[model samples]
Target: MLLYTAMPLELVLDGIDRKYNFKEIDVDGIKLIIEPIDINHGKIVRLISTNPQDYLNSELSPGKIIEFKM
Candidate 1:
Protein backbone atom coordinates (compact mmCIF):
# COMPACT_ATOMS: atom_id res chain seq x y z
CA MET A 1 0.00 0.00 0.00
CA LEU A 2 1.14 3.57 -0.63
CA LEU A 3 2.31 5.48 2.44
CA TYR A 4 1.57 9.02 3.65
CA THR A 5 2.93 11.38 6.28
CA ALA A 6 0.47 13.99 7.54
CA MET A 7 1.00 16.73 10.12
CA PRO A 8 -1.89 18.05 12.13
CA LEU A 9 -3.08 21.49 10.98
CA GLU A 10 -5.89 21.64 13.50
CA LEU A 11 -7.60 19.33 16.00
CA VAL A 12 -11.34 19.34 16.48
CA LEU A 13 -13.73 16.46 17.09
CA ASP A 14 -16.01 17.64 14.27
CA GLY A 15 -13.51 19.70 12.33
CA ILE A 16 -14.47 18.39 8.90
CA ASP A 17 -17.90 19.96 9.27
CA ARG A 18 -16.20 23.36 9.58
CA LYS A 19 -14.18 23.28 6.37
CA TYR A 20 -16.13 24.34 3.31
CA ASN A 21 -14.76 21.83 0.79
CA PHE A 22 -12.23 19.48 2.39
CA LYS A 23 -11.07 16.21 0.83
CA GLU A 24 -9.29 13.24 2.35
CA ILE A 25 -8.04 9.71 1.52
CA ASP A 26 -9.61 7.67 4.29
CA VAL A 27 -11.92 4.77 3.42
CA ASP A 28 -14.65 7.22 4.48
CA GLY A 29 -13.09 10.06 2.41
CA ILE A 30 -12.69 12.32 5.44
CA LYS A 31 -9.44 13.98 6.50
CA LEU A 32 -8.34 14.16 10.12
CA ILE A 33 -8.15 17.55 11.78
CA ILE A 34 -5.13 18.34 13.98
CA GLU A 35 -3.50 21.40 15.41
CA PRO A 36 -0.31 22.68 13.76
CA ILE A 37 1.54 22.59 17.07
CA ASP A 38 1.40 18.79 17.23
CA ILE A 39 3.83 18.28 14.36
CA ASN A 40 7.38 19.30 13.72
CA HIS A 41 7.95 22.00 11.11
CA GLY A 42 10.05 19.68 8.93
CA LYS A 43 7.33 17.01 8.87
CA ILE A 44 4.98 16.28 5.97
CA VAL A 45 2.20 18.61 4.90
CA ARG A 46 -1.60 18.30 4.66
CA LEU A 47 -3.84 17.76 1.59
CA ILE A 48 -2.08 18.69 -1.70
CA SER A 49 -1.92 15.03 -2.70
CA THR A 50 -4.01 12.84 -5.04
CA ASN A 51 -2.70 9.53 -3.64
CA PRO A 52 -5.00 8.17 -0.94
CA GLN A 53 -2.05 6.64 0.89
CA ASP A 54 -0.19 9.90 0.83
CA TYR A 55 -1.85 11.08 4.03
CA LEU A 56 -2.26 9.63 7.52
CA ASN A 57 -5.90 9.54 8.59
CA SER A 58 -6.03 11.53 11.80
CA GLU A 59 -9.29 9.85 12.75
CA LEU A 60 -7.40 6.74 13.71
CA SER A 61 -8.59 7.56 17.29
CA PRO A 62 -5.48 6.35 19.10
CA GLY A 63 -3.78 9.32 17.40
CA LYS A 64 -1.95 9.56 14.06
CA ILE A 65 1.69 9.15 13.20
CA ILE A 66 3.38 9.57 9.82
CA GLU A 67 6.74 8.70 8.26
CA PHE A 68 8.20 10.84 5.51
CA LYS A 69 11.04 10.61 2.98
CA MET A 70 14.32 11.74 4.41
Candidate 2:
Protein backbone atom coordinates (compact mmCIF):
# COMPACT_ATOMS: atom_id res chain seq x y z
CA MET A 1 0.00 0.00 0.00
CA LEU A 2 1.42 3.31 -1.09
CA LEU A 3 0.07 6.70 -0.13
CA TYR A 4 1.60 9.68 -1.84
CA THR A 5 1.17 12.95 0.02
CA ALA A 6 2.89 16.28 0.44
CA MET A 7 2.56 16.08 4.24
CA PRO A 8 5.62 15.33 6.33
CA LEU A 9 6.19 11.64 7.20
CA GLU A 10 5.48 12.26 10.86
CA LEU A 11 2.25 14.03 10.07
CA VAL A 12 1.23 11.44 7.46
CA LEU A 13 1.77 8.54 9.88
CA ASP A 14 -0.66 8.39 12.80
CA GLY A 15 0.24 7.10 16.25
CA ILE A 16 3.83 6.40 15.22
CA ASP A 17 5.02 7.56 18.62
CA ARG A 18 2.95 5.08 20.54
CA LYS A 19 4.70 2.03 21.97
CA TYR A 20 3.43 -1.43 21.22
CA ASN A 21 4.23 -3.95 23.93
CA PHE A 22 2.96 -7.15 22.45
CA LYS A 23 4.98 -10.26 23.20
CA GLU A 24 4.86 -13.88 22.17
CA ILE A 25 5.47 -16.70 24.60
CA ASP A 26 5.41 -20.45 24.53
CA VAL A 27 3.96 -21.84 27.74
CA ASP A 28 4.05 -25.59 28.19
CA GLY A 29 4.31 -25.97 24.38
CA ILE A 30 1.32 -23.74 23.61
CA LYS A 31 1.86 -20.37 21.94
CA LEU A 32 0.15 -17.15 22.96
CA ILE A 33 0.12 -13.41 22.30
CA ILE A 34 0.40 -11.34 25.44
CA GLU A 35 0.33 -7.69 26.40
CA PRO A 36 2.30 -7.02 29.55
CA ILE A 37 0.46 -5.68 32.55
CA ASP A 38 3.49 -5.78 34.85
CA ILE A 39 6.98 -7.18 35.19
CA ASN A 40 5.75 -10.70 35.87
CA HIS A 41 2.24 -10.72 34.47
CA GLY A 42 0.50 -10.12 31.16
CA LYS A 43 -3.01 -10.11 29.82
CA ILE A 44 -3.75 -12.77 27.20
CA VAL A 45 -4.18 -11.32 23.72
CA ARG A 46 -4.82 -14.46 21.71
CA LEU A 47 -3.79 -18.06 21.27
CA ILE A 48 -1.26 -18.57 18.49
CA SER A 49 -1.15 -22.28 19.05
CA THR A 50 -1.82 -24.60 16.12
CA ASN A 51 -3.38 -27.23 18.35
CA PRO A 52 -7.12 -26.87 18.65
CA GLN A 53 -7.00 -28.05 22.24
CA ASP A 54 -5.13 -24.92 23.22
CA TYR A 55 -8.04 -22.81 22.06
CA LEU A 56 -10.55 -25.03 23.84
CA ASN A 57 -9.11 -24.23 27.24
CA SER A 58 -11.32 -21.51 28.68
CA GLU A 59 -8.55 -20.37 30.95
CA LEU A 60 -6.40 -19.34 27.98
CA SER A 61 -9.02 -17.04 26.50
CA PRO A 62 -8.22 -13.40 25.73
CA GLY A 63 -8.28 -10.88 28.63
CA LYS A 64 -7.20 -13.52 31.15
CA ILE A 65 -4.14 -12.42 33.09
CA ILE A 66 -1.31 -14.94 33.23
CA GLU A 67 2.06 -14.71 34.87
CA PHE A 68 5.13 -15.32 32.71
CA LYS A 69 8.89 -15.35 33.07
CA MET A 70 11.22 -13.61 30.61
Candidate 3:
Protein backbone atom coordinates (compact mmCIF):
# COMPACT_ATOMS: atom_id res chain seq x y z
CA MET A 1 0.00 0.00 0.00
CA LEU A 2 1.06 3.54 -0.58
CA LEU A 3 2.36 5.35 2.48
CA TYR A 4 0.83 8.64 1.32
CA THR A 5 -1.78 9.64 -1.18
CA ALA A 6 -0.58 12.44 -3.41
CA MET A 7 -2.64 15.61 -3.39
CA PRO A 8 -2.27 19.24 -4.30
CA LEU A 9 0.70 20.89 -2.54
CA GLU A 10 1.11 24.40 -1.12
CA LEU A 11 4.44 25.70 0.12
CA VAL A 12 5.80 29.02 1.32
CA LEU A 13 9.37 30.19 1.26
CA ASP A 14 10.84 29.95 4.76
CA GLY A 15 14.42 31.07 4.12
CA ILE A 16 17.54 30.16 2.23
CA ASP A 17 19.88 27.35 3.39
CA ARG A 18 17.57 26.36 6.21
CA LYS A 19 16.32 22.95 7.22
CA TYR A 20 12.62 22.27 7.62
CA ASN A 21 11.07 19.61 9.77
CA PHE A 22 8.26 17.33 8.65
CA LYS A 23 4.87 17.93 10.14
CA GLU A 24 1.20 17.30 9.61
CA ILE A 25 -0.60 19.59 7.23
CA ASP A 26 -3.86 21.13 8.42
CA VAL A 27 -5.34 21.13 4.96
CA ASP A 28 -5.11 17.37 4.18
CA GLY A 29 -3.73 15.70 7.31
CA ILE A 30 -0.54 14.55 5.64
CA LYS A 31 3.02 14.81 7.02
CA LEU A 32 5.60 16.78 5.10
CA ILE A 33 9.05 18.40 5.26
CA ILE A 34 11.06 20.60 2.94
CA GLU A 35 14.84 21.01 2.83
CA PRO A 36 16.88 23.35 0.73
CA ILE A 37 17.92 22.05 -2.66
CA ASP A 38 19.56 23.33 -5.77
CA ILE A 39 18.07 26.51 -7.11
CA ASN A 40 15.91 26.23 -10.19
CA HIS A 41 17.48 28.40 -12.88
CA GLY A 42 19.01 30.57 -10.17
CA LYS A 43 15.63 31.45 -8.79
CA ILE A 44 13.80 30.36 -5.62
CA VAL A 45 10.05 30.31 -5.42
CA ARG A 46 7.15 28.57 -3.73
CA LEU A 47 3.35 28.49 -3.53
CA ILE A 48 2.69 31.82 -1.91
CA SER A 49 -1.08 32.02 -2.12
CA THR A 50 -4.10 29.87 -1.64
CA ASN A 51 -7.59 30.19 -3.06
CA PRO A 52 -8.58 32.56 -0.26
CA GLN A 53 -5.07 33.74 0.67
CA ASP A 54 -5.15 31.83 3.88
CA TYR A 55 -1.48 30.77 3.94
CA LEU A 56 1.26 33.11 5.06
CA ASN A 57 4.47 33.78 3.17
CA SER A 58 7.71 32.01 4.09
CA GLU A 59 10.87 30.74 2.46
CA LEU A 60 10.83 27.18 1.15
CA SER A 61 12.74 24.77 -1.00
CA PRO A 62 12.02 25.26 -4.64
CA GLY A 63 10.79 21.75 -5.38
CA LYS A 64 10.48 20.20 -1.95
CA ILE A 65 7.29 18.27 -1.32
CA ILE A 66 6.01 19.65 1.97
CA GLU A 67 2.84 17.59 2.05
CA PHE A 68 -0.47 16.89 0.40
CA LYS A 69 -3.11 19.57 0.38
CA MET A 70 -6.76 19.20 -0.38
In terms of lDDT, the best-performing candidate is 2
lDDT of all predictions: 0.39, 0.88, 0.34
Write candidate 2's Cα lDDT for 1-70 as tens digits.
Answer: 9989999888878898889899998888888899999898999998888788888898899999998766
Question: Tens-digit lDDT track for model 3 on 1-70?
Answer: 3435365333332365566542222223322233323332222233333443333323233453343223
Which tens-of-lDDT digit does each residue in 1-70 have in candidate 1? 5534474445423466664432233324544443333333122234444656645545343234433223
Q: For model 3, give the 10-residue run with minimal summed lDDT.
A: 23-32
In model 3, the runs with Cα more than 4 Å from the true position are: 1-27, 36-70
- The TM-score between candidate 2 and the true structure equals 0.67
Q: In candidate 1, which residue ranges exceed 4 Å CA deviation? A: 1-28, 37-59, 67-70
Superposed by TM-score, candidate 2 places the C-alpha of residue 36 at a distance from the truth, in angstroms, of 0.6
Ranking according to lDDT, highest score first: 2, 1, 3
Per-residue error for 58 in candidate 3, Å, reads 24
The per-residue C-alpha lDDT of model 3 at residue 11 equals 32
RMSD of each: 15.2, 4.8, 15.0
